[model samples]
Target: MPSGAVRMSRKRAPEPASQLGDVPERKRVSWGILISQGSWADRSPLHEAASQGRLLALRTLLAQVTPVTKGCHANIATIDHVTPLHEACLSGHVACVRALISAGANVNAATFDGITPLYNCCSSGSVGCLELLLQNGAHTRARHAHLPSALHEACKRGNSQCVESLLAHGADPDLKVPQLGSPLYVSCLHRHADCSKILLHTGANVNVGRGNDSPLHAAVRQDSRDQVTLLLDYGANVNSRDEDGRRPLELAPPGGPSQQLLVSFQGSPRTLCQLCRLRIRNVIGRSRLKHLPRLPLPPLLTQYLEHM
Candidate 1:
């Protein structure tokens, strides 16, 4: 044990709530024992097992411990309030996560720094862990101003599967952070074409980004042809100005790939099919796009809506 080890108490009373709106308040306060004087924080054997992906060890520990410390969401934590579920998700340990969830772990339980299992899983790029959390009704929200939303993390990490799962589970693609912009913009900033594509398919606003900068502008600055092409296909405004009052094309090099691509689209008309697709998508609305198949549409048209 480190010198000056001390037991820590809960920072605030737990709020018995679910779902993350504008800004999340640590919905459930968790308990932890830690060294108040050192960098090392107290962790249970269950936390160790989950973080190491030792499913069998975790299950045995779960059976041996009292119900309070048996891997429940609020049972154990580090000084920062990291639960076993948080540990498992951080390491992308699917089996450990499943076991913890089975034992009634809180998927949405946030740490002192506002880290949640969903955010951890996204950071680890684990689709399995992400899916499990969503199925358990974990709201993809963040509580700290310092951390980005789960969707933003997924986009920044370029985890298309996580992005898709988050969207399907009702993550706001347009949810903006003070410094990180929207999920779509994060995807573009990171040059994650697949993630950007997924956001557009889910009906994220093509024009939204950090304050005045657009996703197209971010893509241009990064010189990512794939991201730029995806944004253009998704109907990003070419004339959209950033806070610096420059169009995306202006940010590109004198004759770089982005500039060339922008020039090609200038004075050109989008295909009739593309125009029709955008029109239908706008009418259907973001919240209703997932239910497009259930609408009275042809199979071919539905496929177009999904892929095109």
Candidate 2:
């Protein structure tokens, strides 16, 4: 198969461990049975153990297997190219993940669908597994060709902890997928206010999105008043229009909170203080906004600068 290509195997229910063959009663077993029988199965025993978070079984398998580089079974993939590492990360089994990585599993291995172990960790909201992958050199920016970035996946799932972990590890919040636009856009679409806040605080481009659909546009479409307020606080352009030429206020449903809030903003001019705060935040840039608390200012003034 071509690199990173996934091939679907014939559908078959997972077989029980009893049918795989008997082994000597010990903590660790030989790889001969796993290699002989699992090669033709949908997944290897290692994959099953990792996916189920069977730490002891995983460790025993790892101990018995030779180095992956020597054609050992550590990095074995299923018919669909899903590795044990992928299984472990997908299931949020940190111990199995660490064991797989220690046994020389490829941390950045991509499956047929282009989903990397790091991406699976984010999709599963496994912050521990995600961090373990990053610490072991998983590519933070690895894309699945068709799927969104790891940051986008975390935001899509409304996983603020995963979002924070990805950002702290240098994942780009603005990295646009073909249809997903920016992570902020996805967060707003899902009404994940906390994720949106984190993305904005981390310097994501508030105006970036698919076509003309800015984060503000998405927030309004979702009718999330809190998200709209948060976006406005972070300097999102209230007058920004979508692809259909409808501004955020125009997109708001009639008589809804979003509409009410938007109408109010439209009727009343922004305060000079609010405008100045927005200007300062814009000038300082999103990446540097976090440092506002350390500036030589009073606590109240610093809170204002941080938009607290």
Highest lDDT: give the candidate number: 1
Tell me model 1's lDDT, rounded to 2 decimals. 0.78
The lDDT per prediction is 0.78, 0.77
Model 1 spans > 4 angstroms off: 1-38, 67-74, 143-147
- List clash counts for every candidate, in order: 0, 2
lDDT of 2 by residue, 108-197 (tens): 877665668887777778899998988989888864545646787788878899999989878888888887888899999999999998
- For candidate 1, report its TM-score: 0.82
For all predicted structures, in order, the TM-scores are 0.82, 0.83
Per-residue C-alpha lDDT of model 1 across residues 1-308, encoded as one tens digit per residue: 55533222223232233422321221111122231234433777888798778988888887876766655533577777878888788678999988888887888887775768888787778899999989998987676555658888789778899999888877888888888898999999998999998999889999999989999999999999998888888778999999989998889977789999999987587788888888888987898888878978899989898765
Report the C-alpha displacement of residue 232, candidate 2, in angstroms.
1.4
